[model samples]
Target: MVLLSLVASHSDIDLETVAKISADASQVASVVLASASPVAGAITLATCNRYEIYCEVPQSEDVPAARSEVITQIAASTGLSEETISTALISKTETDVIEHLFSVGAGLDSAVIGEREIAGQVRRALNEAQASGTATGSLVRLFQAASRTAKDVGSRTTLGSRGLSVVSVALELATDLSNDADWSTKDIVIFGTGAYAGATMALLRERGAHNVSVYSASGRADAFVASRGGTALDESTLEAALSHADIIIGCSGSDHRLMSSDITSLDRAERPLVAIDLALTHDFDPELGALAGVDLITLESVRMAAPEEQAQSLREARSIVLDAAETFATEQRERAADAAIVALRRHTQQVLESEVEKVRAQHGCTAAAEEVEFAMRRMMRQLLHVPTVRARELAAQGRAGEYIEALETLYGLAVDAPVAPSMKNAAGCPVTGTQSAAAHHDAPMQSPALRQVG
Candidate 1:
């Protein structure tokens, strides 16, 4: 199987393009299912800075054609021109896809390097795909491994030691000029009741900023405040909240400006109000920065101020990710080899049992016939044990594909035959099978391994 991906992230694509090219997770599933043929399963990861689609396809399929089909589907779903979609995406397959996923899960590819949130995002994406019945088999395993790799990076290295996040950076900037005593006296007004708002509030509470209020552009402010323990403010009280707030956070996900001319009109002491806009689209107007007692920080500024990882830490993080990817690939190869090993063992057993039965019938079930049967069984086991062990060793050494191919050529194993749900992993690798163990003598065997072994 080929692991194929189409990625649009902050690394290459601009924010506007990423937003335009992005598809809903369910929409991505629909597009994968709409492919012509040979598509196994798919998973979509759509976050603030990225929109990625990971799919499993037959290795023999024409890669260029499959990619074009995927691109066409994305264009149709996103209402973007095919050229635009093609330009916005970076395609990866096979080992490259594995490496990219590991890096992403570890936050190496994020705008804020080594951020802790991406690991959860990757896991959540996988869970969502599984829940929607979009991810299966090898695809599931690939994502699960990626999540594990991220965890390893976090726990085993200092890559994630800073716990850097956009919200965290914003908070740092807000408190950079204030002392611990100032935090106790500070009043913070958060404008947005969404995920970013919640994160900001949590960070503020963690930093001992207790006098915080919530302002909603929509009507859900009261409920949000109720859940998170903050006072909700409406339009009538918004000005008052702003007047009292020393720090204002805007993450309302609105295209329109939340800070109007009223911000300038509000009565205030000489204290400067720091406004941090976390929205992808500007929630605060540029003019707000020009106010006499206001300092406005945009998303771009926050990203710039994000903490950088040391070179050694970055190298360690990448090393960890690559190692995890290699381990996952190795395990997959071993599992592939296991299917063939099981098939070969089963074939040998069936042959021994058949020959023993023939001998018994010919010899009229004598004690000598039973001795011959036992001898033949022992001989077969001895003859097959070395080859089975060698096959598994080859798999662990990254030569499993060649071994599998040789096994199929030598024994005519039908490795492409449909397997039961329980037998297949997310990548379409067969885990276990025994139903057709004794049926190999038939022509054109349809078992997952050994189409024919005579």
Candidate 2:
């Protein structure tokens, strides 16, 4: 199957549009798989600033239909118009799909370059797709390679060594806006207990901020704070906590927004409060930013404020991603020759069996006949070796169809369609080895060809 990717990210669309698409992204994969005729499988990756769908289609010609179907499904799920959805997404195919996903997984495409959180987000997207049974073998391989590439980028370069992320960038903005420019003395209140919330808490601590309070509308604050070294706030105490806070960071991603009135009604705090909204689905109202004595920082602000990664480090990381994408593309091309290889092997086996049966009938299963059978089998394997190697070579060069046609013309053989491998490594990586024993059993032997008389 061919790969197709539809991407809507901060680069092409506004963050508000991204957040709107991301709101229902969790269900898009299942919806597309159930309704899209040309889509064999799908995986959705929705982060704060991006919403992307990776699809597997039956053939390259089916791409437009698959893209339309995916957009229709996304519109149906997100209440967006087909025109708007179509306008927002950029479609990527072939090697571009591989390169895009690898760049995304490596955090090269993040608003905060070299952000460590995106790698985990990419991994979780694949896991979610697999759990929903919407992931195909090709997609599994694609994502696994992405994860490996991310790891390589992380290990080989200094891009991600400073622990930079969306949360950290927001905090940096908050520190700058603070009167003291010090985190250790600020009374920080963080909303939500999700991954971003946890990240916020850790970064706050790293800056020596001790008086941290966590509030979760879902009542998870107590457990969240217990392990993370923060005090939990219940509904009755939330207003009191807000009154004392010097900075507020929102990452809850809950629908229950904290309106401007909520902040205005709090008890007196003469000092300025920097409110950082990190959630895609904002926790604080936009009007809160306009309120007196409150300075608001949002994801957009963080995006604009994010520092550029070191040049040499970024170059090194990008090189890693490029190498990984090329390797993945080569492996995919080699797999395309599997059907022709299998067909040729089966044809040779049939001829050998027919000749061996004739020898058995004449020699009555004697050692001489056995030796003759061995010699013939070895000779056939030897004759098939070069053609088998050539099939793979042509496939890698995107010419597998020529090899298949040659097989049909020379031997009257029809190659069976290759099936996606069902086997996975224990670590969930796709098994890229020769798919079956029959295709690889005689791979090692070599010899000269003898004319076949029918």
lDDT of 1: 0.76
**Backbone N/Cα/C clashes per model:** 13, 1
Residues 1-454, candidate 1: write the lDDT tens digits: 6678989888886776886776433365545554453555678887667889887765546567667877888887877899998888899987789999999999999878998877888998887666555565688899999998988899988987977887888777777734333566788888788777888888887888788888887788899988898888888988888887898888775544765586877778767888887765556776888888787876667667887888899999999999888888777667657667777787777878888889988997789998898889889989998989898889788676777677667776644424423223355443222322222224363455456643
Q: Summarize candidate 2's per-residue lDDT along 1-454 as a digit string, tens digits.
A: 6999999999888988888777776777666666625777788998878999998887889999999988888888789899988998999997999999999999999999999899998999988777666777799899999999999999999997888899888887877777575778888889999888988898888889999999999999999988999899989989898998899889987887989998888775666788999988899999988999899999999899999999999999999999999999989998888877876787688878999999999998899999999999899989999998999899889898898778777887766554433323354433223432333355454322223333
Model 1 regions more than 4 Å off:
23-26, 34-37, 60-62, 176-181, 191-194, 215-223, 233-245, 252-272, 281-294, 363-370, 395-401, 412-414, 417-450
* All candidates: TM-score: 0.81, 0.90
Model 1: lDDT of residue 126: 81
RMSD to the hidden true structure, all candidates: 6.2, 6.0
Which consecutive 10 residues in model 1 have the weakest lDDT in total?
A: 431-440
Which numbered prediction scores highest in TM-score against the true structure? 2
Q: Give the top-scoring candidate (lDDT).
A: 2
